[model samples]
Target: MRLSICAVAATLFTSTIAAPTSKFDSLANTSEESESEIVRRDGGDGKYFHEPGGDNTLGHYDKRYFHGVVSDEERRDTQKHMVRAYLDFFRKNDLDTWIAHGTLLGWWWNGQRLPWDFDLDTQVSGATLHHLGEAYNQTNHSYTSDDEQVKRTYLLDVNPWIWQRERGDGMNIIDARWIDVRNGLFIDITGLSETHPDSQPGIWSCKNYHRYRTDELYPMRETMFEGVIAKVPYSYDKILTDEYKESALVNTQFNGHEWNPNAKIWEKTEETLRQEEEERKKKEEEEKKKTVEQAQMA
Candidate 1:
């Protein structure tokens, strides 16, 4: 009887499985579109996407899939789940990946994302990037909450321009993204490649123009990030210091928030709140002035 039940369960699971869609196969053509065309064609609303004059190489941000911005408390809750799911998926697939940039800095401070941050950053080797683009791009992964009350789907979208690897045209720096289809939040995944394998074998570079020596990255260390096991560069301290400068490691006050050692969270400073209130009022006044001018012109 037990064997019969096991067979039935396995059959049921197999019956319910469905194939993934190739939603991102056409992304290759958009590789060189002007900034305006990119947002229009990609369904990005410009809220979280790259600005016209801003860094164009950053990964694509899709507003159509976004669930709109929520309060800070709610945003953090969603992010916590997003990151854990991301790490688990990569590990189970046996793909080599590690945290990078601000995400790495967050792991250094609290083994998680910084409270103020809205996205995550991760990286893969050149081989891994190609494999993912070919096999997993445009795939959707479904995850259910612990209580089974909420289910969110994530999309792994690969950049078609992964082949143009020479930091060319300063666009498409980010190689791919693991995106939360429900909220538009995502982890930017870049690929690291040999800058000059023939001459500078030890040197590597990302499309973003950041360069690193092998000793700074190799032999990745295992660590906890956002409550899941994750990998980080070996010389994390030096990497952070090199990118953000030494003061970033020691500074307690930043971006109108202060670190609370006991609570292990960044709290909004009183001054920051006051400044925000003033800014809100100023914006209101400016809007009112614009309304009056428009009325007079009409």
Candidate 2:
């Protein structure tokens, strides 16, 4: 049940774009192709340049992932299912995963999925990634949906460049992913390894140039996230504060979206979706008009 990314992307490009209530919203707010030299390279940053939200990948630093429009409700539901699916898969195989970065932030906030998050983040030991790359790369693990009628397929795709211990992996530093085979939404899994044998004993770094001391992350704390058992860094509070600053832990209204205590969901205070729709329509109209003019000249 394993398939190449190109095969999946080509198929999805022809499929109906997901609705506004679906589980994917291409991160429209990111500054695509920033001046960061770490990203302006020959092969670009991410390996798979997906068509918008057609894939679960972030398409980092490029305007790569730009399709699919899912609502808040659909987004949360999908997040839950996706995380649960990964939990089940990892437990069965004895692969350890812990919530990191934004996923950890979500756990700190409410032990639930962040409404603003479009993807999930976790980390595994370097050995775990190597085991996956060897044994399960691109292998499909299928599970029945929550309804128990239809089936869902997941792929554990590992990157070949996981051995590059240097800090300049660009977007490729993401050593592996657990992808939802249906629509390509995936959770980014990074490998945390020692700096080098000769270097300091506790030095650690990720592909994204994120360096950390070993104690900052060792001894993963098992906890519940989105109703499923999960793991987080030992120093989750310190990690969250260090990465996101103090406001992220306390601020409820940073993004255009706000966390509603009554509904227990993050809701946008403004018509951001409506505005984006108008922008999309305008872009389409402009393209159509250009096509009409070209036809007259031809």
Candidate 3:
């Protein structure tokens, strides 16, 4: 079912961590919260219902949320907070993590975000995810922006499902998310499980997801991404190629932006690069002709 942006936004905003109390209240207030409604709808039976929102009534299918029309300014602001939360988690736990997939593609060329990207993707080991779930569930992080008035609070969403890997469903390893509730932008954290057949020591086993050795992914590299401290995989090229073919590195058009074979965005940057190359070639030819004339005189 399709969820509307407003409904999704409302659900996310209200699903905050419950205030801690020394004693559990047997009769916890059960006022029908937006999040609970959303959860019920998602987990509900086949019967669909309509929800009232002013003159228009939104249906169950209409409420499913995907990528919405987020402004560029809003995206940039949201990305900054998401990156900060990721870095904070890594630093606190000493876990090695790096940007992957489309996020890495953005970092590769511009050292910035893909203006059209809806979310961020990062990779961690199975062990790392396990560590985070146990130690960092529902942690709060705060970052002060360059402007003193803009203080952002972020929540760490480490799903408890990371430890349930015995079922053989590989895709379930996606373990955590650093969600920006205000903007609906999130960072998806996936665990790269070890895959091996014999269960031998130093041999990893990944039943559903792709397998890689610790040595292959170790020695994380430091890189600047979206104007923040970021980590990248050691063999980033291999990872990219495995996920997306070599063409993806060169393909410019994706999401909303047009892929320019010659330029970065296909609109302006390619033209600039082409002009620069043409000018360089013309200068080289002129220099060559001058050298030939000088040689003939000698």
Candidate 4:
């Protein structure tokens, strides 16, 4: 079933990290809260999510969680769970958001994440951004698969510089993130607002300078992505074309992978590529032989 901007704001609550109750609960809570709370107290140097061993200005994924690069199957499975949990959390928290960037493009193709993408992207309205920060920043949401075999936890962490509407220092282009604590994979959540409200009437933009018209985004369309109901921009085609150009929608082959319509997914096979190369060589040989035969006849 489709879900729209108006349909968001559901009251269902997902599981969250239970508060520690051991004799060391106080110490554990202090340590656990310090990571994010310290950044907030420092007035934020504009960096939000920090890498475990790296600098604090890390933009998207946290390397510590990965340990090492995961296999393709693991990445896809984790991403799918991440997106579904994000949608569910937003709905329950009464927040409005939609798939954006590469994630949206994936939806257009087959309601799935792009095979080449290692992360996901989403967007929230300016108002929703405030609500998220004020109400759900640094909150965790946990969910289980339908069969209850797989369980995943996600953290909704908001950028402290969210109030700075303009694209000031560029350190906080992303307004927030839905992070999977297990693998450190996360969904970038940018916020759209009227950066120049007095002059730019209908224009909307994020800190990253990605702009869209009011009508192009309002009354968002609803569809499913990664097996969960989600929202998308109203003029998705136009928006995507503006960002990625017309080829994005029409080009089926990308990054060594080709769309398999029969399977309804993109596939990459070394054997298939080898076979294609052999077939191409055979055709070229046939054309050369025909040319030689024609010359002899003449």
Candidate 5:
């Protein structure tokens, strides 16, 4: 009797979220209230359903909610929403979080989302995870944006497999996620815990098998991400260089892109890059033909 009632409720819930003509209409037409239906459609919390054992990978989410391929604008909105919602929650609860990985790299160049990046990363302490588990796990956060006049729902879901410290499976590395319930956009959160492996006495490790020094992450620096103030590693320079490379910090042209200081973003039209490549190839071909002709005449 209870299952039937829940099923009927879920059906009704999904009906209400049908995408509207508005620009801000959710790319994925459902929210957390209808999550049970989503789970039922797929055996697990869906993310990367194509990859074997992807259901187990922490932070790699499936975009099954999207009816078709996601648009760039939708990707941009999803990223902004993910960060804005996350920062709001942390600020409200007095929880400390630091931007890490690609998200931090993006902040270094400009206070904008990296055009090609969708996955976001953040970190907190082990104690913080437990605190969240006890008080806020499986919690749904609803936020209202006056500008867009849209209410968005987010979910904080933690992985119970984190208790097993062995770090054997690649599938279960993500400690938790702050998920955009409507679109499946999420910020992957990992808890750094103190570990005493044979190599060192005081080493901080995460379930993902990453080890760091105790002092490395401490004294988090205040910085802005996606236009909002947030925390970053104290030794950002060192961390960024280690993860990416020294040239990555200085290179303006990457992936056929150039920085536009006025816009404060990477901007290069596909046609422009294509033309440049073609011109270069044409010049190379001319030089090669001239060299061969000269050699044969000699």
Candidate 6:
């Protein structure tokens, strides 16, 4: 969900290239050595190399600027594919997982998506994490439609840490990522560490990180998210309260759009007037200077 404004404007403002129908076929026919080593060469400032971590700290540089090059349509398609892949995996394996945080917010209404959603979020159990890492790590799965134009591809990227059981503060419990390589949209999967029976109920706890009991998380319930079957924490009210307080549900303006608190949708409107006014004043000042110069020349 980290976007560099300059990067987005530069990449998306231009026309899109039609994706080649035979692209995946060509990739499939290529040698395994070459395919395994396919790396995106680095350029520009060292900015692109920075690792995206908690809260997008690495990706957020200028408050106004974001990184990555992708169109809105392409971005949406990427996210949709990611969600589909996760659901497919869940259905096939019969694994129990649920949407969390902003993702859960999307589920609060219809099973559809929020127009401004930046990324996908979900959680899995430790046992389920092991099952995926062992069988589906770094695997490519394709979704095809009867209409050839709608087909898309995705990859399951399972991290190695799922197998390692080290109790420490810095470790991340998440085991895998559902990636839309073509557009870079991804879903983050974190594990809910199992607690001993003697431990208190109602306090959510994770041994790999700071501990919290189930009470901290309160209730969990069944919910549908991203047009798929899933579950979500019942403590969503408390969770949002801590993170955004009442503002999480408050209608506010961002990037020339009004974000609806109740519906969690971003609507475009007169919010862009300020940006337009600023651009207009700048042009007027430049024009006035040119007029003065012309009179002196005469």
Model 6 C-alpha lDDT versus the unseen true structure = 0.52
C-alpha RMSD of candidate 2: 14.1
Would you list the rank order by TM-score, best first? Answer: 4, 1, 2, 5, 3, 6
After aligning candidate 2 to the native by TM-score, how far in Å is the CA of 9 from where it should be? Answer: 40
Pick out the ten consecutive residues of candidate 2 with the lowest summed lDDT: 17-26
Q: Rate the local accuracy (lDDT) of all candidates.
A: 0.70, 0.64, 0.55, 0.72, 0.64, 0.52
Q: For candidate 4, give the lDDT of residue 206.
A: 82
Given candidate 6, what's the lDDT at residue 195? 43
**Which of the two candidates, 2 or 5, achieves a greater TM-score against the reference?**
2
Residue-level lDDT of model 5, residues 1-298, one tens digit each, is: 0121232223221112111111211112432335455446446654213222233332245343333345557777878867888887897787877788888777777755677675788987766765675688779998776477667888888755444343544555676788776666678888776644455644666666766665566566565566565777656768788788888777777766777766667876687768878998999999999999999999
lDDT of 4 by residue, 143-171 (tens): 99878988988888887667766777676
Task: Pick the winner on lDDT between candidates 4 and 6.
Answer: 4
Give the 10-residue window scoring lowest on summed lDDT in candidate 3.
Answer: 19-28
Q: After superposition, how far is residue 125 of candidate 6 from its true place, in Å?
A: 1.2
Query: What is the total number of backbone clashes in candidate 1?
Result: 0
Which ten-residue region of model 5 has the weakest summed lDDT? Answer: 13-22
User: In the order shown, what is each candidate's alpha-carbon RMSD?
Assistant: 11.6, 14.1, 18.9, 13.5, 17.2, 13.8
TM-score (C-alpha, index-matched) for candidate 6: 0.58
Task: Give me candidate 5's TM-score against the actual structure.
Answer: 0.68
Q: Judged by lDDT against the true structure, how good is candidate 5?
A: 0.64
Worst 10 residues of 4 by lDDT: 17-26
**Cα lDDT tens digits for candidate 6, 106-164:** 45433545556667777665556656666777788887643556666667766544433
